[model samples]
Target: MAPPAQSPESDLTLPIRPGDKPPVPLPTRPTMIRGFTLACPVCGTRGLFRRWVNMVERCPTCHLRFERIEGHWLGSLSINTVVSAVTLLALVTVAMVVTHADPPIPLLLGVCSAVAVVLPVLLFPFTRTIWSAVDLLSRPLAPGEVDPRYDPQELAALAAERAERDRAGDGSGSGLSDPGPRTRRSDEPRPPRSSRPHDR
Candidate 1:
């Protein structure tokens, strides 16, 4: 028989354990807005970077590690490149349209060069957060990725959600399908007989 279909929220529901960190609830618009504003994508805390090029190791508020995995910043670099290219293309198009037949080649080159250099620098920080948000959205938080102390409000909301799911007859109170009881199969491997003689 085919497995039962699960709701979208049910997919996001993680199994709660005693020492496990709570799952970070990612609301799309709000998370993206926070990223655009150059704040912590997971927690919305500001001033994450001390320098324009240097971001802190982790978020102070939620302790979210910015670089979730190795080479994570590569996504941010790609985002920066794409944004810079788009900005340059738009500016060049506008300049060409305005100048028409009397386009000043030297002036256009100078402006483009400046934009190429500056826009990436200006967008660097924002791109990092944006990419982080995008990554988080694409790949939901794994265990131990964020800080242990989850936000009180978020925890409360999650608890309420679980309660509702339980009341709705989801079977498993954890919002997942219960396998019922375990039954060992005949084909399953059995422990080998002891070679040593039994002690008296």
Candidate 2:
């Protein structure tokens, strides 16, 4: 079954498929660019955290759940690592080329070391929020995807949804996929275990 519609308060600007329109207007800026503001990607609420690096459970305005799943920020780490590595490599290459392949080692070491410490710290917010935008672009938010702990009311609702899906006509869903009935050929007994290599 199709997922439920998104909330009108969602502020992220995403591509529109044919014949689909958001209930609310899209943000003026692209979602990734807006993500750099460290706002909630869905609602663009700037107060997404209590302090540096400490994200709130959900958006205060739209209640869109951040940390959609455990380890959702793992990709942020990858982003930071790749960016830092590339930046460091670029710095090293520039120093080598400008200084005739023998740049001041101490200065290079100091600059790279400081960047190693500062870049990740400064980019933490960007990395995480941008990763959210990337994730959202790849997989648009589905109905009832919020984390359970942050929204207890959704528990009952999701339960009902799953139950209804299960109760739909058998072909509509897949779980056990049980064959309701079976017939025996000629009503004959099966072969003995020793002779039934095909009957695991």
Candidate 3:
């Protein structure tokens, strides 16, 4: 049998049509970086984190999972490490350039070590959020994406239908036929209407 018609406001269960494209183009490295800075994949919005160092459950606007998969942030850690190393190297280079000589070896090593250790902690959360947005943009929707809540009316209708079916002797069909008490037909009732005058 064909699937039952969905309520008008209910979510679409079928796949999006082939020709229907997203309004924005698929994300690239630059776009992904921008998403990370904005804290949302689709639109650049602030407040991506609900608490300090903790990602929001989902993007406020796009609803993309902030942490798409467990351990996905490890990629961000790698990126952070590379960036921090590059930054320290550049700073050391700039210092050597300005002074026309390298700093003392011990001093240079201490500075580099301090930066390398501290930089990752400072950049870690931002990198992770950005990585997640990029990953979400690159992926196809997963099976059975659903909103957590349903319309009140639809829920009420379903409840009423279930209750009516339960009240009927057999709930095999639509339950529209009113099965009288003791499985008798309403047309076969012999009691005078006056005896149930209060029902009016």
Can you write out model 3's per-residue Cα lDDT over 1-200, one digit (the tens) per residue? 99998796796576779865443333466557766575555445578766656777765654656556788778777888889988998989987987788567787889888998888878877787667655655663342221222222334457888988787746466667767667557788675656545664
Q: What stretches of model 2 exceed 4 Å from their correct place? A: 1-29, 145-200
List candidate 1 stretches off by more than 4 Å: 1-25, 151-158, 161-200
Among these predictions, the greatest lDDT belongs to: 1
- Ten-residue segment with the worst summed lDDT in candidate 3? 143-152
For model 3 the local lDDT of residue 72 reads 72
| Model 2 pairs whose backbones collide | none
**Stretches > 4 Å off in candidate 3:** 1-34, 99-101, 143-200
Best-matching candidate per TM-score? 1
- Tell me, what's the RMSD of every candidate? 21.4, 19.9, 16.8
lDDT of 2: 0.74
Mind sharing the TM-score for model 1?
A: 0.65
- lDDT (0 to 1) per candidate: 0.84, 0.74, 0.65
Candidate 1 per-residue lDDT, tens place, 1-200, comes to 99999988879876777866455557799889999999988779999989998999999988888898999999999989998999899988898789885679899899999999999999999999999889888876765566645543456567989999778765545666667998989999987987998799
Residue 56, candidate 2: how far off, in angstroms?
Answer: 1.4
Per-model TM-score, in order, reads 0.65, 0.57, 0.49
lDDT of 2 by residue, 133-189 (tens): 777666555544543432324444578788887778555665767778887798798
